[model samples]
Target: SRLQIVCWTVLVISAYLVILFIRFLNAATITDPFNITIDWHLWALLGLSASSAVGAPVIASAKAAKEPAPLQQITADGPRIDTSRYPAPVTKAAAAFSRTEAEVAATGSGVLYGKAAPADARFTDIFQGDELNNAMYVDVHKTQMFLFTVIAIVGYGALILNMFLTTTNPASLGLPAVSDGLVAILAVSQATFLAGTGVTNTPT
Candidate 1:
C-alpha cells in the first residue's frame, strides 16, 4: 500500500514537472520569435498548463482504499470455476468479451477475431473486431502511450523541418504548438488513466 502511494505521488508530480518545464522553456528560450503577432510561448504555456491539470486523479485514486480480489467459488463438491462461457484453448494475448452460450456453441473464439495482423507484426496490428469491441475505458495501453509518442516525434520533426527550411531558405512550415498541446493532453490523460487503476505512468 505504501509503495502504491509513493508511485502515484510520483506520477502526479511528473505531470506538474512537465508543465513547469514547458513554461520555463517558453519563458527563457522563446521570449521572442521572429516578430510574430502572438507570443506563441505564452500560448504554449497556457495550453500545456491547462492540459497538465489532468494529474488531479493521481493523488485521489492512490489515497483511496484498496479492494480485495475475488476469491474462488464453492460448489457442492468443493470449489469449481464456472468457465462455461470461456472458450477452450484460450491461447490469445487477451480474452474475449462475455459471449452467450448459444453464440459460443456456434461461432467459437476463432470466428470472433477474424482479421489480419499488421504486416510489420508490431503493436500496430489489430484484429478486425478490435474497434468493434470495447475492452476497457481505454483500449490497449500501448496505443495510449503511442499517442504521446507520435506527438513527440512530430514535435522533433517540426524542429528538424524548421532547421532544414531555414538552411535552404526562410520559407517553411511553422512550429506546431498544437502538437505540443496534443502531447500535453496525452501525458495528462495517461496519468489520469493510470491513477484510476492505481498504476503509475512507469511502463509495465
Candidate 2:
C-alpha cells in the first residue's frame, strides 16, 4: 500500500510539472493579462492521483465483503487418542525425525501449518479465531477512511493554490514566482503521505 501511494504521488508530481512547463511555454509566447487554461494534462493528473487515493477504501471494502464471518466451529464428536491411530511416515525424512523436534515446529502437538492435520483433532479458540477473520477488514476500513480525509484536504489546498497562482496576476509576481511555491506545496504533500505510510506500517 505504501509503495502504491508513493508511485501515485510521483506520477501526480510528474504530470503537474509537465503541465506547468507547458503553461510556462504558453505564458512566454502569449502576452497580456496572463490568460491561462488547464487542458487535458492537468485534468488527467488530478484524476489519476485522486483515483489512487480513493482506491484504498474500495480494495479494503471488497476484501471485507469477501472474508468469511468468524465463528467457533463446534463438533459433536470427542477426541480419539489412540496409539493405533498413528500412521506410518510416508517419507524417509519424517520417519527419522524425533518426537521433540516435530512437537516444537508443529501447530498442535505435532502438525505443521499448511500440511496434513495432526493425529489428534484440535479446535481453535473463539477469541483468536475472531481476530484472525476480522482484523484485516477492520484495519482496512480504518486506514482507508484516514487516507481519504488526508488526500481530500491536501488535494483541495493544492488545487486552490494552483488556481491562485495560474489564473491570478502573474505579471505582478514575476515569471517564476509560483514555481518555487508550487514545488514546496508538492513536496509537502508527498512528505506527509510518506510519513502517514510509515506511521501505518509501524509495529505496535
Candidate 3:
C-alpha cells in the first residue's frame, strides 16, 4: 500500500512536469542544430521515474505472508514420545497437558518448526496459486518498470556527460541537451512506470 501511494505521488508530480515541458517546448526556441534543450525539471522527473521503478519490486518483496499461530504447525511430523519411558514426575506433567500443548512440547524442541515468511515474492511463488495470480501479475509489471528505470538512468547519464564535455555554455553543462530520441526514451520510461502501477492522473 505504501508503494502504491508512492507510485501515485510520482504520477501526480509527473503530470505537472508534463504540462511544464509542453509549455517550455512551445515558448522556447532551440538555436543549436545538434543540441536539444532539456531543463532541470525534466531531470527531476527522470529521477522520480527511476525511483518508482526500483521501489516496486522491493515493496512486493516486503509483503510477507502472515505468521501462523504458535504451535499450530510444525515443519515436520515431529519426534515420537513414549509416555511409559518418562520418569514419574515427567509423566505426571505430560498427563495434565492438553493435546495442542502436548504437540507443541513434543515438536518445539526439535529442529523442525513452522515455516518462515518469504524473503521475496518471486513471480513463480505467487503465480502457482489462483488466489495470488493478481499479485503476481502486478509484480511482473513492477519488475518491468524497474528494468526500464535502470536503462533510463544509464542512457540519461551518458547523454548528460556528453553534453557537459562537448558544450561551451554554462547552461548546457547544467541543464544539458538531450536528443529527441533520448527525450522520447525518458518520457516513455515515466509513462511505463505510471501505467504499470496504475497511478492516478490527479496531482497530489
Off by over 4 Å in 1: 1-79, 86-138, 167-183, 196-204
- The candidate, 2 or 3, that scores higher on lDDT is 3
Query: RMSD in angstroms, all models?
Result: 13.6, 16.2, 15.5
lDDT (0 to 1) per candidate = 0.37, 0.37, 0.41
Pick by lDDT: 1 or 3, better one: 3
Model 2 TM-score relative to the real fold: 0.26
In the range 37-125, model 3's lDDT, one tens digit per residue, is: 44655665556555555664443333222121332223356864443443222123234333243542343222112112355344353
Clashing pairs in 3: none
Prediction 1 global C-alpha lDDT: 0.37
Cα deviation in Å at residue 53, candidate 2? Answer: 13
Model 2 Cα displacement at 80 (Å)? 13
TM-scores of all predicted structures: 0.31, 0.26, 0.32
Q: Per-residue lDDT of 48-123 in model 1, one digit per residue for the tens?
A: 4343344433443442222211223445888575644422322221245344434332332321222232342433
How far out, in Å, is residue 70 in model 1?
A: 11
* Tens digit of per-residue lDDT, candidate 2, span 1-204: 333345546645554465455556558644643343434443443444465466544543433333221112223685543423332221211333333424322422111111235553333211111122121123433344345535644664476456546754433322112233433444445445434322322111
Error of 1 at 52 (Å): 15
